[model samples]
Target: MLLAIDTATQAVTVAVHDGATVVAEHSTSDARRHTELLAPSIRDTLRAAGLRPRDLSAIAVGVGPGPFTGLRVGVVTARTMGLALGVPVHGVCSLDALAHGVMADGERTRFLVATDARRKEVYWAAYDVTDQGVRRSDGPDVARAADLPAHLRGLPTAGRGPLLYPDALPHALPQLDVGAGALATFAMGALRRGEELLEPQPLYLRRPDAVPQSERKPVSTA
Candidate 1:
């Protein structure tokens, strides 16, 4: 069994996966309530799946290109759970989850995966959907919505970024949210194949909004 969690964007998703099937899952799209909502949702999902923490063989979490605080909540939970349960923890790109959500629908072979970065910029990547699964071909770059590479302008896009910058990407797709199931599925495939999972690290593409006062240079006497 696997426990999956994602709090990388406005969405808060939690799921319990029994092999390829998602046994129980819960999700809510409230950007302001990640901390308050995540633990309860995980508890509810596990209960619905009829499993306990010890039953989880591994934990898969979305390590995101997201706001600092929201992204930290998920990663920290996964790490703490892994320590408590004595199971391995796997980190996955949140963008890959968004891509998988779209690929499941058998959409175009190629498209862009993006998510809101909340500074009038987006965390974007390109994916090539294949029979094996979704493969990332290009960026996981952060750029101003209007400054996206010219080549990516018209391609099919998914995630909240398109919703935020409609004109910049006209061919936006409807499956904007990435479910925790997709995160579990992606991690399971890699584990089954004995492939190395992405390092358990948060992919915060830019420095956080909060900075330490120590990093600031003191005013020099003039």
Candidate 2:
């Protein structure tokens, strides 16, 4: 069994996949409580599925292009559990997981998967989903929604970022809002296939929302 966790966005998703088939899954959109809620949810999902931590073959985590706090919460939890349970922890790109969620079986098409990155920018990726599964075609980049390239205009798109930023959506392709379950499913497939797992790291494509100390101005007295 493969246990997967995704706290890459506001949503917190957990799933138990027995190879390609998902035996159980749970998720909720609680941006403020990911730290407090994730562990209990994981326990409940596994208990509901009649499994234990040691029963899992591996653990998968969404190494994110997400906000720092929530992204770290998921990765840290996964790492801690992997260490305690002696299971290998695998990392999956958050955008790849979102694309997997949107893809329909046997439909070969290009797509863009996006997630909100606040400050009016988005974490985005382009993909092609064929019978073999989703393949990354373009970046997992951080870009302003209004600056989306012309080539991406004709492809199908999904995720909260695009839905939230409708002005960026072109008329040529369909758009859908997919979530974390798809991510968990996709990550499970990668783990089962013996894919090389990347080191867990936050995909912060741009600078964080903080000013440098040197850039700060000092207060003056009259």
Candidate 3:
């Protein structure tokens, strides 16, 4: 079994996949409680599927282009479970998983995946879907959506960022939720191909919101 989690957005999702097929899945739009909700949800999903942590062959997590806190919650939880169970932990680009959720086979198309980054800027990337799967053609960067490459204009686009910056992607496809089942499905493919396990890490496209106090410049007293 493969256990997967995606805390890459306001959503906290978990799933159990037996190879390519999902046996169970759970997700919520509880943005503030990822730290609290992740564990119990995982347990519940596994229980619903009648499995245990040790029964999992691997843990898959969304290595995110998302807010620091929620992203860390999922990555850290996956890492802890992987260590405890002595199984490998793998990562999938959160956006790629989102694309996998909607993409169809044999469709030659380019796409831009964007997610809300919460400061009027978005985390964006471009991709090309092929027979092999989705391949990233642009960035995981923080930028104004209007600043996305001109080449991306004609391609179908998806994810929360587009909705957050509709002006930047005026002609793109309507956004859709990228759920836990997609994450698990992508991870299962990786496991089947014997890919190396990845350590969980945040895919921060830019600096964090906070700056150290010491780095703050003193206000002029004149």
Can you write out model 2's per-residue Cα lDDT over 1-222, one digit (the tens) per residue? 878888888888888887757888888788889999999989988997899998987888888888778888989998899999988888888877777776643365787777788888878888986667779989988888778887774556676765777767553233332344565677766656877766766666776677477666877886
Say which prediction, candidate 1 or candidate 3, comes out ahead on lDDT.
1
Ranking by TM-score: 1, 3, 2
Model 3: weakest 10-residue lDDT segment is 99-108
Q: Judged by lDDT against the true structure, how good is candidate 2?
A: 0.77
Question: In model 3, what are the clashing residue pairs, if there are any?
Answer: none
lDDT of all predictions, in order shown?
Answer: 0.88, 0.77, 0.80
Which of the two candidates, 1 or 3, achieves a greater TM-score against the reference? Answer: 1
In order of appearance, the predictions have TM-scores of 0.94, 0.86, 0.89
1 against 2, candidate with superior lDDT:
1
Q: Write the per-residue lDDT of candidate 1 for residues 1-222, one digit (tens) a residue.
A: 999999998899998889878889899999999999999999999999999888899999999878899999999999999999999899998998878888878768789987888878888999887777789999888998789887886789989888999889778888777799888888888888988877778997788998877676889999
Which candidate number has the best lDDT? 1
**Top TM-score prediction, candidate number:** 1
Error of 1 at 76 (Å): 0.2
Off by over 4 Å in 2: 105-108, 170-180, 210-222
Tens-digit lDDT track of model 3 for 1-222: 889999988788999998859999998887799998998899999999999787998889998888888898989898888898998788878887887775633354777777788888777778887777877777777787777677774466777766666676765565455589988887787667786645678777777788577666889999
- Count of clashes in candidate 1: 0
